[model samples]
Target: MRYPANHVLGAQRNGVNHVSMNMGTVPPGGPVRGTNYPVYPDKLLDWYDSAGAGPMGMTSVRVMFTWEAVQAAANGPVPAPGANYANYWTDLVGVVTRCLARGMVVVLAPWQYNPASKNTDITYQGQPIQPAMFADFWAKLATAVNAATGNDQRVAFDLINEPHTDEESSLPGDIGISLDGWFTCAQAAITAIRSAGNANTVLVPGMTWTSAKAFTTNGSAAKWAALTDPLRNLGVTVHCYSGIDSPGSASPTVLPDACSALVQWARAAGAKVHVGEIAIDAGDNGFPPFGGTLALAQAQWANWQQFCLANDDVVIGWNWWGNSAAGWWNAGDSKHPQGHHWGLSLDDGATRTVYADLIAGSVRTPRLVLHDNLADPGTGENTTTSVAWESPDIWVRQWADGGVVAEPVQGGRSCTVYVRVTNRGTATWPATGTDVVTLHWAKASAGLSWPQPWGGADPALGGRIAADVPIPAPVAPGASTVLAIPWASPPNPLHYPDQDGHFCLLAAVTKAGQPWYDGFTGTNLNTNILRMSHVASRNIHVVPPGQNRFGSLVVENPHREPWRVALAFEPLDPWQQPLPSVQGRLVLRPPEHVLHRLRGMDNLTEAGPGRVALVEPGRGLQGLVLEPGERLAVPLEWEGEAAPALRAVAYDTETGPGTPTGGQTFVLGEVEGWTVEERAALV
Candidate 1:
């Protein structure tokens, strides 16, 4: 299996569509602490215990354990009983233990290393707090937790929370920590854990100036690479906010540059990565419609979560900023007269719409789907053989563009076996217009190549086929048909580890049409022929009574590749002839209804193979793309009084010399006593 058993969370069948927010470090060690705001009666911990426990402790809590708490009591005697953690650490054990007894997972975060303030007495030996402090704190915390949760391995830890170079909001003129400082902190912390005989995994943040945070790659990378131990599987935690970027838009799906770049980089590293924090500063204050920050936040969160889902090999989770009430930005409780609030929740116990959305979307871990061996009874030579399938409740049907696509058009993705046979003996194995040479296989995914098995053909259904099939049909002298049909691929069952699997692929078919048109051809959608229920008929007319001056383009050579057609019109001179504008530029006649253009904008912009455009009939008329064996009737007419004559051309680009040419054209003559509505019908 290429993927590990736990990789279901990373199993991006299509991609991830939802993301989480870092709602306040869910009070790691304490009895119960809300955001920066005071917890309701400080007994909020009791409230959580009452709430349904999710997969983790007290609902699978992934809490933060601060270094500031672990390293306090500086130069003093180290104390006899030590810093009193009864309120913070001791109470936390109760939360974890109680939740564990109820079957919940507790994810721990060993917090940051805020180096000493540069100036002031905050300096340690003329330098900011050294790396030793991080290691010291981590070791102490690990020991405390190990002793605390004797039987529960669910008490795993994440290394730090947003480590960075600049220590903002520092005392005025205070020298802050550097990126190199972050490296030392990460390394020392890791070493300390292993030295203490523990194997808890810690997530590490990638080095660089990502988003509004300080600390660029220069120093962070230098310090990180120098680490002595191997830190291969540790996940990368990143922060992303959705404010400012989604301005003026509702349901904004934003993904900013910093977060996007990091996602890409982690992709290459093949390491686990996730957005640790994505916040919206506005708490539904209803600011200006085009609020730049708010817009950016929403868009980034939406796009980032999707990007993460697409790269599940490395990315499997995300957390938007703090929950509860205190917003992430205004933690100081400062007035927002100058700066805006960055928290997603309000102090009045009201929560932002995005708050609940993120938590519902947060990742606890991966879920998997496994099944095997679903095929047909026997194999034959060059004949249509339909296969059977049984799928995990959450199997996903994926496509070529990495989006949801149908089978048949999706090529090799629809079926695993290719049926090929030759008639060298001059004998027809199967008659024409019949399904022959059907290949059978099951569709499923496991770790890497060994994904859990999904759609396996059911043997009970006559050779494991969806519908009963007749005996081996014969093909004529020269005839063929492909047995491509619609098969179901569902997402992981609810509360299942593998909800990521979806649908994929959509496109043209390679098999040729048979003389006998059966339901499979255009009647039913089981096969790959995109047979639309109805097509737009040509509508053209001229001004006069009975004289028909308008014309239609007789579509020959039906389209094989994708197709899109937009009507074009040119202005009429006083002489009443269809001519390009004075500048010879053709006029674009926008369609009344929204047209679903096929994906190939690259060709629309530049000229190349498979490029499509409007074709011209005579003179300056343009051309368009129209594949052979397909039909599309085009309507054309001229506008004028006096029963004048003017030629209207219809064409597709690239179908000719990458220009418009060789198409049906028309000239509208005059009409007498025709109502304007009648004129509309004539033209």
Candidate 2:
């Protein structure tokens, strides 16, 4: 949903119940779809509501508050509705009222903890909160909330957020606390709320950050099951990040079964369950430093949401951990720090993430995704040879080669282009044979545009349509299948004998009614390849060592106006760096120079061993000016020596500054052989 720009909790700078300008009628529904809102209130109500069209389509909210904000002193009176802001009472009431008016089911939760106290008790101000004080606080809160909203059944009380022992430690379940200790305080709060004549649902969490898996593993299930509620309207709350109880980087292989344990426990305990907090990083499945793909994050959310929907008998709802600001600031703590990535929207709260559609459950159609780099799915321009093959999903096989290979497009020879597609959605793709996979080829270039660079109905663009293959079998959700298209003759590399003879293959999957592309307009190949899942491009080629290879990169200005463009080559380790066994250097020359020449030229500068930049004589490392639609062929000559493999990415940056506008990664090496077993092992 939407959040304020700053981290303010509620209205009123001091102690006064002020009138909230924003108010509306509450909406009604079931099976809560909600997100966590910041502590305070602000004018950004539409941030989440969006005038009834929720950004996240959220029906409820889990509001956060601190124990200190609720109770100023131990065993002291909890301020009433009109009470001053000494305890944030007025602000709390105002927030709850506003949320209800906007038709959002508000779940009030206390973020109370004092790890330094070194005890299992809920602490306030670094001291243990007495049971009597805890009960008194809940009793007062219940009365205030009841009176404030006429006992709105839509309101809920989440006992506490992620309760655990060893308050000072960041790890959840580090040193286990006695379940009985936590239960005593929880039961007291429940009793207090019920005794206050408030029937709003109460949610109790187990020890160890309320992780679903830990709920039963940590012996919390049995104790929590014993908790008694007079209203019999209680539920269990749990938190999950990357399929675990603790917040950290997401595991690509880890199937999200966060609710499995809780489902079993809930069935046995006969208690409803609510996932209070859940989030996956948008970047590389929400983990940093270790490269990953958006597909990983998409899978996590899809599977989790599916599980929750499937087990609606007990699991009632879930809340995304939070906004971008909180997520980024916490990164320093090394918890779930990539809040921007985890947030539904990017930092701006306007641009939706790739996983937003999945989170919103707005679309249930099949989403077929073809990975550019299997090792790192979302990375479009990949040169990593650490995994034998970068674009494992796409390969070429010819009887002459005797096996499957990723490079060396044998010109004028009959070959089979195999592309693997995975259905990442919840629906199955029917076997109508209409789900077509078309492969388009374009001249090897640092930047290539759609339709024009690659051919369509127009034969003037080199007529580069390689093959179109359709699937004959139904592709079930989460399942993958390979489509093989027989190419009578691939473009003869002999036609351009002076060029490297490498072509960039673009594969797009289309169904009868499904969108032709997933967020890809095809103008920016470099960026779109990484963002779009339904389309993938492969531009890798292997060259023999000690031989000079010439490749022509067609750099064009896609925009209408003239612009200055720069070309830069970045050295990359086909085998991720620091490998002593694999070593090599890449050498480059201008098109005007002879193939055997080793001398540097005036137009080129050695930025590093294998890295070089095209420069103008008077202007140091300058770009060339290109008019609209001007296609410039920049011939590149390069050779590799003394290494298993050498790779570099040639970037065609339009603006000359900041990030490159587009680029392509080229690799030089022997083709990595593929086997029948490897083909069968494709996921």
lDDT of each: 0.34, 0.53
Model 2 is weakest, by summed lDDT over 10 consecutive residues, at 5-14
lDDT tens per residue, model 2, 357-400: 44665223344567655444321223332221135677666643
- Report the Cα RMSD per candidate: 27.2, 22.2
- Tens digit per residue, CA lDDT, model 1, 301-360: 555454543444445455444433233335212344533333323332232344333333
In model 1, which regions exceed 4 Å deviation?
A: 1-62, 74-83, 95-107, 110-127, 166-175, 206-231, 242-256, 283-300, 325-368, 371-683
User: Runs in model 2 with CA error above 4 Å?
Assistant: 1-43, 50-54, 80-87, 113-121, 167-177, 244-256, 284-292, 324-341, 345-349, 353-358, 362-683
Best by TM-score: 2
In TM-score terms, candidate 2 sits at 0.44
Q: For each candidate, what TM-score against the reference? A: 0.43, 0.44
